[model samples]
Target: MTSSLHLPRRRRGLNRRQALAALGAACALAPGAADATPEAARKLLGDLVKVAPKAGKVKIDVPEIAENGNAVPVTVTVDSPMSPTDYVRAIHIIADRNPQPGVASFMLGPDNGKAEVQLRMRMAESQNVIVVAELSDGTAWTATREVKVTVGGCST
Candidate 1:
């Protein structure tokens, strides 16, 4: 007696190279995959920092070398008087090498007490990461740091 459950046959006709090419095409067409490139980060930064004149008093802290790319710590600080009159409105973090370069964005208010942010994110390789801050007065400030990643975490 033969089992009715028959598994699908593997495509032995396709060579390794062809299979790899097909996989690459599929990955490129996948939603969110194509947008996970460094270019996306650039676009995001440009949109967030539209009015360059407003950018000032922003600071970023990043390690020179990240031992692990899976979780690198980042810190951002802004010089502002956390009051209703003048306060940090938001902070944006972008990693150049990561698949999703747009790491995080934090929205702040006067109640935050201070214009500071800290978080951990994944890095794909060695590249510049930018941090931008926006204030209630419609001013923006940015800082960048080059982070070296020993092992890439975005890709296998």
Candidate 2:
């Protein structure tokens, strides 16, 4: 009797090792496996903001070097009066080089008390963190911060 590993070529099936290798190769050649680029991040920003975001009023607070990219602390603050007439309407966070650039978004109003948000974000690698704050006056402000990640967190 022929052993399973030595079956006739016409009836043979992929072994465990061959199957894993084929799967890995297929995944490597699959579309959309590449990480998000700066342009992708910019495109996402454009979709959220009608006009180019001005570089002011928005601030990003993050570490210059993150020991771990998993759950890295992030804070986005907008210098807004937080009044009904003049307040932050939204806050968007983008990771320029992450697998998926869009990190988080928050909708706010005068009732939120302050135009600040704090959260932890996973990063795939060292990249720029962008913050855009849309105000009630149909204007958007932005800020960027670069963080060096020693260990990536997105995959883990």
Candidate 3:
């Protein structure tokens, strides 16, 4: 007896060239797939002009214990007047355990009223989240927070 339900099937007809191309693409992404580590996080920080950013004047808000790994709330606030002369230039959020350490970055101008940013990010595992704020005066400040995750997000 044939059932009335129908299901989609994957196309598996691939020639040698197509198979090689697919294999090459998979190989190309293999390294990047496993590149997320503490060292990767450090590499991202090192790429910045100021790797050794001082810790101060910035507050990073993240849940101390996150049950869901996906869509974790993150907020970074800088203590600044946000005047034309003094304001936050950029804010970089880093996730130590994500597929890529560089989670997101927000660029702000003097016209922006406040030096604060709020967004959501993903966490792979329990790790420290770092926030770095670059000011118009060529100064960078950073803050770090450890978050515990019950389930993993990326590569899980």
Q: Which candidate is the best by TM-score?
A: 2
Candidate 1 global lDDT:
0.78
Backbone clash pairs for candidate 1 read: 54-140, 55-140, 55-141, 56-140, 56-141
Clash counts for the predictions, in order: 5, 0, 0
Top candidate, metric lDDT: 2
lDDT of 1 by residue, 50-111 (tens): 76734458777889999888888888899989999999898988877555668888999999
Worst 10 residues of 2 by lDDT: 24-33
* lDDT measured at residue 151 in model 3 versus the true structure, 0 to 100: 69
The C-alpha lDDT values of all candidates are 0.78, 0.86, 0.81
| Clash pairs, model 2 backbone | none
TM-score of each: 0.73, 0.79, 0.76
**TM-score comparison, 2 vs 3, better candidate:** 2
Name the better of 1 and 2 by TM-score: 2
User: What would the per-residue lDDT of candidate 2 be over residues 5-98, giving only the tens digit for each residue?
Assistant: 5675535445766887986555344444464689889988999888789999998989999999998999888999899899999999999987
Give candidate 2's error at residue 82 in angstroms. 0.3
The predictions' CA RMSDs to the true structure, in order, are 8.9, 7.9, 9.9
lDDT of 2 at 58: 92
Worst 10 residues of 3 by lDDT: 1-10
Model 1 TM: 0.73
